[model samples]
Target: MNPRTMHSIFLKKKRTMVAIAMLSVGSISAQTFSDFSYKGNDKIYTNNPLKENEFYSPILQGCYPDPSITRKGDDYYLVNSSFSMFPGVPIFTSKDLVNWKQVGHVLDRPSQLKVEKGGVSQGIYAPDIKYNKYNDTFYMITTQIAGGIGNMVVKTKDPAKGWSEVQKLNFDGIDPAIFFDDNGKAYIVHNDAPPKGTEQYNGHRVIKIWDYDLEKDQVVAGSDKIIVNGGVDLSQKPIWIEGPHIYKKAGKYFLMCAEGGTGGNHSEVIFMSDSAKGPFVPATNNPILTQRYFPKDRRDKVDWAGHADLVETPDGKYYGVFLAIRPNEKGRVNHGRETFILPVDWSGKYPVFENGLVPMKPKLKLPEGVKNKTGKDGFFPNGNFTYIDKLTDKNLDFRWIAMRGPRENFITSAKNGVKVNPMETNIKALAPVSALFHRLQHEDFETSVSLDYKPKSEKELAGITCYQSERFNYVFGITKKDKDFYIVLERTEKGESKLIASEKITLSKAIKLQVIGERDEHQFNYSLDGKNFKNLGGPVSGDILSTDVAGGFTGSLIGLYSTSSNDIKP
Candidate 1:
């Protein structure tokens, strides 16, 4: 909802379309409308009320955090951490940096990403994608934590055609980032333990650099050097010194990192050095960006702002892509960490965030000729337009992700839709489960999928699910008992499953399950006639699936799924 303009209302009821002016914070007058449609209050908004020179924050939404951006010519490419989701490292391209469209995933093939026994939030961590102009190659270096493959690099001349094989790196750390210097030298910077055998504080960490050899596609031996120890301002004891990126600007090397962990105190710090390998010095005003300085307020409380990457526009102006959280409730961030873009201020020695660490600015200025774009919340009609996963489609949608890496034969052709072959492990297990899901783009959206499945025994269950992790999820599935099919709504939290509601019906046909998710609450619905849906249970509080409530680094996913007691082949 842009704060400047008021668009027309498309109402199902003729007399109820009345325009009302609402005064919001930031001294902005917004014209809001309550759009009524069929099925009572369908709670849908038509489109964003766009205003000139006014853009929305959070350029990328819904769990797309730890962003790494690169500019090639007039085109901008962005990628984010996919955590445990298979087909990881979602890639997006933009012409004006305002309107972005997901182009592909870095880990698109089964061989490229294998998350068989990976934990819920353990596969990939903070991937850094860089384009080498001299060699005409794009490189992606990341840490496969749960996969136990450590830091690895993958490259491609044409990103759309997939990347080269994994080049295993011997770096002993997470959040590995590759920096290519102007002198045709490449360096790898990462967060690692503080000098092995030295006792340190809980969050004490160090940033190390290594000469990367692109010719051999490996790291140069005996070139490791500690760049920054104990973060910027070592006396302050800044914890969780991670997410490092090195950039050369105005003949000075700038090292950026996230400090104070990734939660409430998360912040972006800057260090400058004469050489990439030399000792880095902290800026006078260290922690170039942070949200912790803001006074706690009831109206607006945004937290967890850090993990940033910088990209210079064609005009020589710089912009930054960072991660932040929008908590629906106090201490409850349900939407997960999101990526935001803000202008970079370089009047001083070190670059700073133009807007500081403010979560969502009402309006932001864009580059010349670029249109302002905004993100909306509600039951948007075409919000899922890019997702093309159909019942009869042989290939899954690019937006659809599997639990960890998906097996080639997991989903096969069925009568009218795809049949999901359930793995032996359930959702409670630490290993990857048999589930395919799409990102929960909006917290206040309804997702429902109809499946033609009648379980043969209690071992087989299949329906829709709102999953946060292996140990935290809500499922509306149908479990069979001999001749009867039991439609059950279950909740799993911390490896414990509790049935919320259940209904028994004769084994007749497939069941249609639905889950309505709102900012405050959630509800489960089921339909047998395909025209009418009945409430399956009472409203479940939405906080259960939140990152604040269910501690993790990833967001929730809502999609169709199937599972069995034993390995069920499609």
Candidate 2:
């Protein structure tokens, strides 16, 4: 989760966490990649393992943020914001919430997403998923900040069977959520600007409710009204009152929203109303969930906590899934914001996130009648884990994603690897390029892959990218210069690219490229015969790859990329 998007919320507004791709090209210049491995070495994960009934805090590790959850009987489905990544909205399934597995994406086709031409940070924003029991269907609504598509919705009877095409909504705002009343009435709630002239402060926003037409998939015209003005209190001129969701509890309406932007001061506040469209009053104890009040220097801190969605268990327990940043030891927003879960204490009139006001802990007690199955059997790995992908004709894992488009743009089948046809557009291109990525899931991790390729000219290059966005990233690749082969490490910050280091290497058969991250520092290395790796860019600062420094809504992606439009030189 990018606090920068939090800025967009205010204005409007991994771990070895590497999405690295492995390239294996033939000696004759036929590009193929294989034998890739990623190892998470964070002490918090390696030293501690889940007990008999315990699990980690971040059930879905890596850049899975802006979490929204819904329950269909014993089945629970969760989704997260994917920004410009193709197959937008990473969807997951869980029986116990603690053990979650990805069920593919909501927007898996290009026709459903119009983000190929926009910048990486300008695509899909906050995505809210809900279940309308009235129709026996699941709904996902979000703001596509690019390609002229504002707010839209997609539906699916079963998430595993893919979703419907984008049904453009008539509302105008971000983070739109749908609620279905037991009487079969439906309402739409979202964050929008105040009435034309009533605009007060810079970031003053309002929560508006609309009578949604379920049959037509549109909001009722002239049926919109502002519910909460400038958050819990108008006098303070609150900023970014967004990510609103409405719930009916025992004949009362409960409206919850994220306030105070998406930075260190981010928070979640709740309001109550007897009716869905009537005047909603703020709870006396607002800010029911936040880490802003906690001391900044607290140990194992979990900051920037807000933008939450709630779901009730069959046993009457309430849980919230929200976005929060786990800063590195250097206090930098490292590996971007991730999805975290906590029990909600709704025994009172209003629900409160348990232990949310204090320094957050990593261990969570398992819910009754559920076993922790993380890091095994395909449930998303949290705490610490390793992933090995031997690239084949079908390409890597299902989670290996591309930006702005599909992976078919370049990947083909090889004997034991993927045959990649480099794209004219490089990694820096805003359009679809030839690269495969995985999210950086941990603070300290090591990723390596072997490449067997011979560049024919200076135009062809292939390597790994430690990418935050197209504007800010580190590209390390092998290219031909004049008559020699060289591996170049280049860093780009805010659109400015600078060559960090490069090395001339003798290509015997294949070479192993590796990147090791120890918190704020990352090192790039290469080995000719598989062992005795030599560092290329020795300990480069990872500040540019953070959400705090780069200013975007996603995490750093490690990519195995092949591009014919190579520009970096040794």
Where in model 2 is the C-alpha error above 4 Å? 1-28, 46-49, 393-395
Per-candidate TM vs. native? 0.86, 0.94
- How far in Å is the alpha carbon of 97 misplaced in model 1? 1.2
Error of 2 at 359 (Å): 1.1
lDDT of each: 0.72, 0.85
lDDT of 2: 0.85
lDDT, candidate 2, residue 206? Answer: 91
Residue-level lDDT of model 1, residues 273-387, one tens digit each, is 9999978998888777888877666344557889999998888888889998767644566668988778998867889998675544534676778764322221112222222
RMSD for each of the candidates: 12.7, 6.7
Off by over 4 Å in 1: 1-49, 298-300, 372-389, 413-415, 506-510, 566-570
